[model samples]
Structure formats: C-alpha cells, structure tokens
Target: MKLKTIIVEDEVLGQKALAGILKDFCPETIDLADITGTVSGAVESILKLKPQLVFLDIKLGPNTMGAFDILKSLPRIDFSIVFTTSSELPENILKALNKYGAKKYLLKPMDIDEVVDAVDCVIAECGHDGTLLNIDQIKNIVQEASQQHVTKKVSVPVKSGIEFYPIDEIIMLRSGLNNTYLFHTDGMTIKSSKNLKFFEKQIIPEGFIKVSRSYIINPTHVYKYSKEDGGTIFLTNGCTASLSGKYADVFFKMLNSST
Candidate 1:
C-alpha cells in the first residue's frame, strides 16, 4: 500500500528540506504529495490531499494563529500531525497541558526516530476491528491521545529495507490524480508520499469510515454522528459528510452498535 504524504510549511527551505529527506529516506511506497504555505492553502490541501500524514509548521502568517489551529478546527481530520519547528522539544506551555489529561497538546520536534516510532504505533492500532476511542469514553480518550497514544510500527518496504509507521494510527486518506497522503492524530502526522487508498483498506475495518467520496474518518475518535436530510452526516467536530440515502441506515446502525 502506498502511504500518501503532504507538507504544510511556510518556510521555503523547510518544505524543500523535508521533501528532500523523505525522498531519500522512504522511496518505495512513500511519495511527496502536496505543499501549502498558508492557512487557506493548508485547509484546501488537507481537504484535497486527505493525506494519511502531514508535516506541519506550528506558526504561519502574521496572525500567528498557528498551524495547530488548522487541525484544531478540523479535529475529525484524524491525520497524524507531526509538528515541525526549530524548537528541540515540546515547550513547557504544552507540557503543562498534559496535566489536563488530554493529548490535545501538540508535539514539538525531537528527532526523525521519534516520528518513525509514532507512525509505527498508528499501523499497529489499525489492526483492530473495534477502537478504544469509543470503548474508553471521554476520560480515556483524552488520556490515550495525550501520552500513551502510540501507533505500532510497520515496515513500509523499500530498498532502504523498511520505513516503519504505526499503520493503525492513520485517521484519514487524502488523494490526488497521481499521488495520495495520510494523516494521523496521535500527537503527530507521518508522511509516506504514496498511494493512500492502498493503506486505507488496511485500517478500514478498524473504525475508519469513509464519510465523503474523498474523506475517510476513523470512527474511534469521532464524537458526533448526526444524520441530516438528503443523506448528509454531521460529525461532532462540525464537519459534514455524505451518508447517501442508500447507505444512511447501515451507517448509523454500525455507528450505533459501536457506541
């Protein structure tokens, strides 16, 4: 399966540098999919890329609303978000948030291995049919996402031997005519730069539901599920997806049983 990837860095060097590293590191199934330098571009690329993984810079633009605000607004994005910044590690400001017991705190750069390891956990969690997201409820959800939300590593085959990523942690798949992207939500998003749908099937049975023709959401982290007229589905995250009249009943039934 191709692991689709994207980059959302405002810096010219950062974008080129990361893409260069990915090309050199995981060449077999990973491909450099898309690039965006602004908020509007980030949002558009996210919807269009549906990437399984994304490399996002924390701060962008004069407003400095920050890159995380992009994901925060689209939490259902479920894309593994890997933060890119000059900072060596998570700041004290975020470390403090850990006290709240929610993994909502953002990840700061540490090392390439740290990222590879996180992706590995995502792959491992993808193997389950049911997800702890619903089983654990609110408290558990917050805690899991915070510190222990690890996705097991899987070797994405290449001459480089293996590029490991937690296949299960992947939350969404973004696609393009010739490329794809994967987005994960476990503190960071890992990028592969390949055919995302191929990996999508691996985790589909594990709470990952296709909400739109292009968007696939992980049921594990989904908090809202409202069925609207004309077969549209509204998520707790405020994102709307199609539940075509033909599939609405089955979709709700499945979500109901899981809940």
Candidate 2:
C-alpha cells in the first residue's frame, strides 16, 4: 500500500530537499500529500489529509513551543512522526527520542540512506495493519517518553554478544576500575565492559541520573536519600551509593525537573 505522507517543515529548502529525497528513494512506498511550514498549518493538513506518516521538523517556531505543542493539542494521532532536527547535542537528541517517541530522528542536511531506512522501517512496521497508529497508543508513548521511561526492553552488551534486560528491572549503575556494573532490582548484577561515561550518555535520557563520578542511579528505584553521610542514596533493591557534593545540586535539580 502506498503510505500517505506529509512534510511539516519550516524551511523552504528543507521541504524541497526532503520532498526530492522521497520522490527519488521512496517513490513506491510514499505518496506526499502536502507540505506545511507552521504548526497550525501542519496540524490542519494532518487532520484534513489523514496521512499515514509525517516528516516533522522539531523547531517550528517560538523557541518554547514547537511540534510537540501541536502534537499535544491534536485530538487524535493516527500517523507516525519522523522527527527531523539540526541539533546534535545529546540532551536535544534524548528529548526528541524520549519525549516525542519519534519513529526516527533524521539530523538536518538529511542523508538519503537514513531517510530511506526510516521510511522502510515505518512501512515494515505498519504492514497489513488497518491503521498505522492510534490516539491512545500515541498518548501513552508521549507520556512514557516525557517521563524518560524506557520502552519495554534495553540491550546490554555482554561478553558473548548482547543481552536484553527489562528497563524497569535495572536499578542502578556503579563504575569500577574500568567497567560499569548494572545492578538489577532483583538482586542480579551484570558487568558491562563500557565505562560509566558511556552508560551515562546512553541512559541519561532513559531516567538514569549520574549523581556522582562513579554512580548513575535510576530515580524510579530510589528508596531514600539521606544527606547525613555527604548524601547517601538507598535503592529499593537494598543497594546504596554515595552522592558527590559536586553533583548534588545538579542532581537534585534534574530530579525536580523530572518530577
């Protein structure tokens, strides 16, 4: 089936560029319905056209409000969004991935192969389903993403290859000499070859905060925070870690922001 798609981009060049890419690479799978430059215009086009997919640019206008505002106001979300952005910062990338629950994020000055892959992934995932997506599912995805909640599972590298762990089952991470150990809520620990910095970048968007130089703890699993011993955090799984005085202020700020 030819997927109906719309491009919600503010830049004229970006719109043309993406349109050209779709025409060249995704001719068979995608049918471009319309293109709009603003959030209101995009929303109206989306509702009227009822497209199966959307290529949405992240920075629409008004620094504070963007595509997400448009998404939040929509009565129903039946199409999948592939967010496009120019920012390569980790925090921005994380917000796009975790908050928007975007099917794919294409960095600006779009790559043809990446665009093709995103389109292919969407097409493959929507195969034979009457509706590509629905309101309730989108709402849940947005909520979960906003909370930095994990998707169902996470892959952790092991000696052999990789092991899948339930995101919720992870409690904390502690750095050792050269490796980081993942502490699970169920009294199980897994050693990862990557250092704390690697895991920090990977999981920071997934609700894990680095409270110290050697520890990254999942706030959901945190049982108590005691300031007595230079700041000690107790997890629900009977694990404890000390928070560095240097990171305490920022850590609390992040905690408050998440809440």
Candidate 3:
C-alpha cells in the first residue's frame, strides 16, 4: 500500500525540493496529502490531510512554544509522527511521538534508495513477523547506528572561528554548499568547512537527520510535532520551524532516534 504522508516545513525552497525528490524517487509509494510551515499551518494541514506519517522540522520560526501548544490542542491523533530540526533541547517531544508507538525513522539529506530501503524494511518486517519498530527499539537502533558510524567527525570551521560542532551538537544543517550550520541547544549556529554530506555519512547510518533538501536537523532537538505542510516543531532554545514535505522521511527517523 502507498504511504499517506504529510509535510510540515517552514522553508519555501525546502518545500519544493521535497516534492521534486519524491517525484523522482518514491513517486508511486508516497501519496502527498498536506503541507505547512508554521504552527497554525500545521494544525490546519493536519485537520485536512490526516496523513499516516508526518515530516516535521524543529525550528518553527522565532519561537517553539506555538508548536507545543498545537500538539496539546489536538483532541485525538491517528497518525505516526516524524520530527525534523536543528536543536537538541526537548526530550519530552521525543517521548510523545512514541506515546502510541510506531516505526523507528529515516534520516535526511538521505539518498532516495536509503529511504526506500528503510520504509521497505518497516513494511517487510511488519509483513513477515508482524514485528514493528517501537519507540524504544528505534532509540536503540539510532544510538547504535550513531555510535558505529561516528568514527570520524569533520570539524565545522567557519564563521567566527574554527569552531568544532560535533555531529551530535548540530540541530540543523542548512542545504547547499553554504556550509553545514549546527543549531546548538543554546541557539548558536556553528558553520562547517564542508557540506552536510560530510556529516550525512556519520548520521544517516544510525542517528542525526536531514528533514528537508535545504536543511538537516538533529533528532534530539525536536520538541513537539504534527502532520501538515508546515509541520511545527518546538525547540529547547525557544525556536520553531515548519517541517516540509520534502523532508518527511528524514524527520521521522530523527524523532524516532530521540523518542
């Protein structure tokens, strides 16, 4: 069966990029339902889309309170959640995604093949053994994956100085060759010498994530999440950003790792 999905991201270019990638990659497997980039947008989109999966970002704009507020406001939930973003402050949000239990996740800046493999793995596991990825198991996978791949981390030396932001420290890595920007829990951004791909190698196998084509965020930073075009995220640094459709799978695994 095709996966019914929703994308909730705040960035515009990021939004289009998601659609484009899906078009080329998982066209038949994904059925795009809704898209949003703000907390309000997320709520509205969810009401309409009612997707089974959501790609949510951590930074929702200037503040993350709205994202949390929206999640609390939901009267009921029937879908699985996937968070995306660049800060590592909200442990509660991660716990909530597993509140009902579901799949582990798919990291970002992810190749279409990897994503398809993860989803295929999930479905196949379900079909073969009726065993699925629970929140806790997903957590272990992320931790193990993160540890196995983190043999070498490239220091992000840009901007102010040759600051070293560990892969785990980064909450969000912007798209393109603009150098990966790490969004710390304190809300400080650390620039990298290379691009997100440098870090992707480390996180994609285990933890860390890319939520959109232009942005990659850490799973640890997610506060709250929803399914919508503007998937809302409340961060520890009091920041919020909408998760877009382009990054749906990336968001899922990031949150799965933390939750």
Span of ten consecutive residues with least summed lDDT in model 2: 87-96
The per-prediction CA RMSD against the true structure, in angstroms, equals 21.2, 9.5, 16.9
Worst 10 residues of 1 by lDDT: 100-109
Cα lDDT tens digits for candidate 2, 1-259: 7899999889899999999999998899999999998988988898889998899887886543467656866776667779887543333344545444456777677878879989988887774544433455556655655566344454565778556676667899999888889998779899987667756545676767788999988888878889888999998988898999887887788668867
- Tens digits of per-residue lDDT for model 3 on 1-259? 6768877777776667666666677777678787788888788877777776666664677756444444544555555555544433223344444443434433344345545654555445434433334445445534443344332343454656444445565566665565666677567866675576656665565465566656665567777776655777666666556677777776776667566
Model 1 per-residue lDDT at 116: 55
Encode model 1's per-residue lDDT on 30-82: one tens digit a residue: 55689888877888888777886677776786635356456544535445555
Clashes of each: 51, 0, 35
Best by lDDT: 2
The lDDT per prediction is 0.53, 0.76, 0.58
Better of 1 and 2 by TM-score: 2
Q: Rank by TM-score, highest first.
A: 2, 3, 1
Best by TM-score: 2
Q: Where does candidate 1 stray beyond 4 Å?
A: 88-259
* TM-scores of all predicted structures: 0.41, 0.50, 0.45
